[model samples]
Target: MLDLAHRGARLAKEHGSSAGPPVSLLDQEVIQVSSADVVGLPMRCVFALTAMGFLPQSAETISADELIRVRISPAWLRLDARFGSVYRHRGHAALVLR
Candidate 1:
């Protein structure tokens, strides 16, 4: 999903989105990943979900429009044959404990 985020960051950068590349979401979790894990991930697909996950809930409420407003990169979402869960609000700062 980060690939999407990076792309979105770039798109936002290029298209003049008032929203930044989504530092709000990026800063939410404490990442416990290695450069190796990042390498293992399909960068395009992984960051698609990541892009959505990091977006802000409008009026402090999560909604589908808010959820779907930001589209994940098609190339990123379609490349994988496997799946994983995006865990949120755990006891610690957010992390993907692979």
Candidate 2:
């Protein structure tokens, strides 16, 4: 997936467009990964972008999948941050010890 995204980003860059890469939908049966797990891909994508110096350290995850779906500028890797927010917010919340 990362390879695909890189290739896509390269193409977009060569074309002098803000668009990144083509979106790909993996088959659950073939990949054997749940939808919940699938969500991680976006986060990884963001991390990849960050690693590539595309975004800053304070950068947050947006809806990359949606951005790809909407045909908006693909330069930014947007993704649903709800899953990450859940864990991040929980860590800040009061911890109840049973």
By TM-score, the best candidate is 2
Worst window of 10 by summed lDDT in candidate 1: 74-83
1-98, model 1: which lDDT tens digit per residue?
Answer: 33355554564466454654445434433223333223123333334455444434233444434322211231221222122333322234545778
* Clashing residue pairs in candidate 2 (N, C-alpha, C atoms within 3 angstroms): 62-78, 62-79, 63-78, 63-79, 64-78, 64-79
- lDDT winner: 1
Model 2 Cα lDDT, one tens digit per residue, 1-98:
33454544465456543444333321111112233223223333443444454433342443355222111122231332323211112122456689
TM-score of 1: 0.21
The worst-scoring run of ten residues by lDDT in candidate 2 lies at 82-91
Model 2 RMSD, rounded to 1 decimal:
15.3
Clashes of each: 8, 6
RMSD of each: 14.0, 15.3
